[model samples]
Target: MCTAAEWDDFRATGTRRPVNFDADGFVHLSTRDQVHLPANRLFGGREDVVLLHLDPARLGAEIRWEPGVPTDPDSMLFPHLYGLLPADAVVAVTPYLPGPDGLFGTPPLP
Candidate 1:
């Protein structure tokens, strides 16, 4: 997920990637069951974000399973994309603004 402003910048550039992706050589993605926790942990109280529903088949990057934060259990692995995410890979874009008080709850998923 990314902020609304960040999305706008991505549209202009045709590529979407966070600073961490450049620093770490991969873009981070969380699973449906995992996103809420990380969202709260990393973006608590932030209301300007957007949820990007991606289609892995549309991805132009190389994705690899990698260990999550070293603090987590050693067996945990997450998908890391080795290149910028092209807009085409994003099948849907929904506003992820938090509700009042700037807190997020589990989002409805399909």
Candidate 2:
């Protein structure tokens, strides 16, 4: 997930190197079921978050399944993109808002 402005820039440029990409060496991603973990951890109460639904087939082989933070379940492995994220690879985009409790919840699948 990313801020609305960031998403807009990504859509305009057709590709993006997320802020943490340089430090982390990959674009962080999550499955529908696990997205809330990172969203709540990183974005929390922010209302500017938006979820980008990407087409895995278009992502090629640079994707890797890797371990997330220690707080996550031991079996959970997040998807990390090792290259620029092409905007065309995003099939959909949706506003990701937090609840009144100031924490993100799992969104219904598209």
Q: Which candidate is the best by lDDT?
A: 2
Off by over 4 Å in 1: 99-103
After the best TM-score superposition of candidate 2, give how far the Cα of residue 92 lies from its true spot, in angstroms.
0.5
The estimated TM-scores of all candidates read 0.83, 0.93
Looking at candidate 2, what is the lDDT of residue 23?
93
lDDT of 2 by residue, 1-110 (tens): 79999998998998888878889998889998999999999999999999999999887549899999999999999999999888889999999999999999888887
Query: In order, what lDDT does every prediction score?
Result: 0.79, 0.90
After aligning candidate 2 to the native by TM-score, how far in Å is the CA of 57 from where it should be?
A: 1.4
Pairs that collide, model 1: none
